[model samples]
Target: MRLLLASLILLVFIPLNAQTTRKYSNEFMNIGVDAAALGQSNAVVARSNDVNAGYWNPAGLINLEDNQLALMHSSYFANIANYDYAGFAMPLDDNSAFGVSLIRFAVDDILDTTQLIDEQGNVNYDRISLFSTADYGLTVSYSRNLPIQGLSYGVNAKIIRRIIGDFASSWGVGLDAAIQFETDNNWKFGVMARDITTTYNSWSINEEEFAKVQNAVEGQNQELPETTEITIPKLQIGVAKLYRFHYDYTLEAEIDLNVRFEQNNDVISTSFASINPAFGFEFGYIDMIYLRGGMGNFQNELQIDNSEQLTFQPTFGVGFKYNGIQVDYAFTDIGDQSVALYSNVFSLKLDFSIFR
Candidate 1:
């Protein structure tokens, strides 16, 4: 009970900080099969490769020499659901590259809502229900090298959509921009701003049925039906620095802070802030295999408030590359109190590149 109360207090007292809403869109956008494998940390931005660069730092694509394509899939929370990602990058010239990517986050069958009444007051009969929520996006990006120094910049435009049941669907647009710089000492810095202009179209509310139910209980007749178009705010800001050490080993750290801003969106209810800071270290062995591990929202720092609070635990993973192909995986444990989740998350990623 004490833990529950603390969770509630933390949820309620938390102030608005991050500036985005429909976190599902953001989460769905960030999910990566290899992101976990590379340290489950946000710091990998400075170590971008040809394929994963689409998500980490599109600017990194300028470093690629050949046309490359990659695909990745992840099993989230063990079996509760899954996400799939695919991308392709092609070098337009020595200093520029273009890429496109698709991402999908899907959950399994869920209980369907059925209206019911019982003699005991108010209740509904439990029945097997089927439903699912999904988010997907298509992004096109271009990256170019700056002429003055070891710097690069890139931009991506995304088409986003979400589906909930047969009656509800929302669509929106978002964009991301990134900058990267490297130094002679093997130090790198990266900055990214994502979802700069994201907004949802609107959701359906079955006004006729809602009115019938409301009138039956309140004994009041309503003449007009109104629907609300809720606008979720755009999010901003992510930065990271990476340092190379000895023995082909490197350390990278990243911090991402964002907020959910929405009005009339019941799921989120109120404005909330989240700070996700992660650290990762990657070591190369024989110049072919890479082992990485990191912790996120370190120590259950990221929180969501509702009747039940949800907190994420530290996550870790690793990766391997050989003969122009890279394979990655990650593991995550939600915690013990989670009813539907305890030990969960098995992810896999594949990346390929060719040099000209």
Candidate 2:
């Protein structure tokens, strides 16, 4: 473990410059909520050691000895609360590992309102109405070590749902895959692919909003219209490398590139390709205390339209381990030098194990 700690310090001070390019949709709603999944966002990723390897990289979990479970939460930008993730892994009798995990992203108490206009095209504030929105996802995953000497693999399937303030509710499915390679020298290589389907669903406007708008149309007293389908983002790919230092510390770096491709590629915009690069260091004292720091692009969106508004240039976190259990936390801020939408985020995680 001391070797892992040394690697963490070396990577931070070494100043090795690297650049990554990726394709991603600059959409605000999608980016803000799923930020954590793009990479191993919690400090627990470091403290739990190889327990989260199925979500981060299945191959990494191959080296684990204890059975474990964990939960994590993120306070997102724009007054939104992101998801919670839980995972468990156990060692088989033949030196193999098996694990399962569930992930859920949810938001509550969102304000739903409508635009009010006066007859003379002036302002009308008295007519505004309020409602709320809700979105959630549930993912289940399984992973195991391969018979191959140094390979591991895992997969996750999910169901997603969205409701926009008495408007409409939509549902969709998603899948994620991960693989990892480890060498005797404590070096590891990993890859993950997420949202392979480019999930799609639709929601109707709030009933109140729809009625207000419909009534405003000069001669139309029409019935409420049908809901519309909204498309989410597309496939995302991530690659990472880890070097273990002395003790139980590690230095890891990863890059995630996402792209949006529709059935009609000709109309697709080049901006669909977006990228996020993560460089992080984890320090562990024995098998318990941990400290982490990382810097990355595309961690959060500060502006609704400017994709460059991705904040979280640097992040720091800490974790505690006791009796085969772990707790983690991370803090992030958006140095939005140019907008009122500037914000900060906090995340927490807990891990427990039942040895079998």
Candidate 3:
């Protein structure tokens, strides 16, 4: 009875902060990739034109002029969780490009307390063990120009693998499609269909390990555990344009709309689909130094009085590019509508043509 009561208490507090499989399946993949993109609140769907575009809007990969490599790292909750990304892109021909990207999000050194109690019903600190939970994603992307001038299309095939120590594991697969069009005036339009085929994950749980957890709880035993998760498709559309000024100054501004076919807490919701808008802009000096800012992730939060309020996230960042090496940094917050928790993100991009 003591272990059962203690396990019930742990259940209420532990899983609340851990990765869950119920809703938002494969959510780590949606955390965004590059620092430049996240710095601008992921409003770069129309202007992603380098290696990082492999995870943003692959169609923009068609604009790659030289082979490129990108890497980024970010941590959350005072280094409790870590997120990392790496990508490579190259122009295959004058009108085609190819890229590949890898992403990982993990929380390590978690204590497993299910076995902390001995057979004599006494607390045994030495019996506790440590474990980790991690998720990984690998994406391969390709883009090519269409017969129509200034029009390009792209596709992505994604593989998802997840592990929860020795307790559970899963494997998933998904596909994405995207298109980009540029007008004579340098205006760009882009659309991306994420998980167009409805990604599916099949879980495999270790019965022996799970039995320890089951015995700890009071009445968690069920006939069958959930073994599958499905991720529905979503759409993102964006428009952007660049402005050139005297003395080699430039400005780029973009807006993106994310659409999901379900009722949620998005800023714009209806019986059909909900839409959330993001706005971002970049200022450049001589095409070498850049300043970026954005606002996004608008949601309707309920208050104590049952009233709803609109809230959003704001971000800013800076970048320097010299001799084919680019360094970027962003001050970000992932808090939706609660107490703010801020973190720092850094990324680097290398242009292989510089060495050649």
Q: Write the per-residue lDDT of candidate 1 for residues 1-356, one digit (tens) a residue.
A: 32233233223212234222323334566544354433455456665757568777788889886777777666655555667777888889988999998888876464443334444647665632455667788889899999868899988888777665453556667778888887766666776666656544444545544443344334444332222233334342444565566767655555543334443322233445434455566666655666666654432323455344434345566667676666666655544224545333333333444342
Candidates' C-alpha lDDT? 0.58, 0.49, 0.86
Which candidate, 2 or 3, has the higher TM-score? 3
Model 3 regions lying over 4 Å from their true place: 1-23, 222-224, 336-339
lDDT by residue (tens digit), candidate 3, 134-230: 8999999999999999899999999999888787889999999999999999798999999999998888878887788777665756333457778
Per-residue lDDT of model 2, residues 199-255, tens digit only: 444433456645654455456455543333334444434445556668466565555
Candidate 2 CA-lDDT value: 0.49
lDDT of 2 at 124: 75
Rank candidates, lDDT, best first. 3, 1, 2
Q: Which is the leading candidate under TM-score?
A: 3
Model 1: residue 79 alpha-carbon error in angstroms: 1.5
Error of 2 at 175 (Å): 1.7
lDDT of 1 at 136: 84
